[model samples]
Target chain A: AQSVTQPDIHITVSEGASLELRCNYSYGATPYLFWYVQSPGQGLQLLLKYFSGDTLVQGIKGFEAEFKRSQSSFNLRKPSVHWSDAAEYFCAVVFNQAGTALIFGKGTTLSVSS
Target chain B: DARVTQTPRHKVTEMGQEVTMRCQPILGHNTVFWYRQTMMQGLELLAYFRNRAPLDDSGMPKDRFSAEMPDATLATLKIQPSEPRDSAVYFCASGPGRTNGETQYFGPGTRLLVL
Candidate 1:
């Protein structure tokens, strides 16, 4: 079975500091990887996604994720953390045959400290 | 901006009651998906419809949970005899055909609490 793992349950970072959230997956092929962020009391928003070719993909809100086939990882990073960046981040992969749905990880709660 | 819309932002009902949630996808989107988010389960895809046709519903409990798209603009998820365990934030997402590496725009979500 395919599964996504986000090692950190919660992470705290100071404002203006660089941040990185780790994600690892178990799949036979190079799956369609995505990173979504959910603010408190809100729906998920796409931060970035990686399908092929590009190892580093940039997304909205100055977020970026790098896809590493060797490690089966797609990690999200931000150059500088903002208070608004405090949210739950989820890493997901496409597993279904039709490839319309997603299998999401348990997510990592990021806390920005001033 | 065109976005998916879900009705009844919050619903609190007693156990054994029937609960219905509605979603309206973006005008031209061809695929609609239902997902449940819980603290324990994270997020799970309950079902999805393509071109208003049912595709895979394996993630949903067939007995109590049912999903439907009565027409192009509306999609619904209903739970008969709702239970406390069914309490969670349900989200509806839609995209163009096949996803095509396209992003699935999610609605605000309907928060359900079964007492």
Candidate 2:
């Protein structure tokens, strides 16, 4: 079945450490990729999205993601992680077409240590 | 900024009880979606509507789950005789349209607990 997969279920990083959350998808068509962050008891907020544009996309909160067509991956990165960045991160792909309902992966939880 | 809103932030109920959750999509949005989040299943799309019309609901249980867009502002999900397995956070999302960079805006989910 075509699906989105987040390789790491949980990741721990020291404050100020760099962060990378991997997202891989199995799809045949050109995909629109997205990254979203959700804090505890809060709704999901869009981090960044990759449409038909420059492969590297920047989003709010100093987050960025790269869309690598060769790997079918859209990995999220942050140069310096902060304590507030500890949250559940989900990678999504528009199931069909450019903009439509998204298929989300099992999220990766980020734990920040002091 | 405008945001999607959901009603009854939290609810605790017994098994076999009826449960209803409501959502108010952002104004001028033409698409609405309902999703359920569980540890076992992750986030699953339950149903969606386009311009008050049901587009797809294959993810929802036909026997017990029902979703409707009563108006432009209101969308509802009702489960009759809900079970403990139905306990999860239900989220509502909306977009300006189906295509053309219309990304979804999610609401703070309604947390439902069925004993």
Provide DockQ values for all models, in the order shown.
Answer: 0.68, 0.67
Model 1, residue B56: C-alpha shift (Å): 0.6
Per-residue alpha-carbon lDDT of candidate 2 for residues A36-67, written as tens digits (9 for 90 to 100): 99999998999999988799999999999999
Sort candidate 2 into its docking category.
Answer: medium
Model 1 spans > 4 angstroms off: A96-98, B98-101
Positional deviation of A108 in candidate 1, in angstroms? Answer: 0.4
Per-residue lDDT tens digits for candidate 1, residues B1-40, read: 9989999999999999999999999999989999999998
lDDT tens digits, residue span B1-115, model 2: 9999999999999999999999999999999999999999999999999999998899999999999999999999999999999999999999988475468999999999999
Where is model 2 more than 4 Å wrong at Cα? Answer: B98-101
Q: Tell how far residue A56 is off in model 1, in angstroms.
A: 0.5
Clashing pairs in 2: none
**Model 2 residue B95 lDDT?**
94
DockQ value for model 2: 0.67
Model 2's chain B yields a TM-score of 0.97
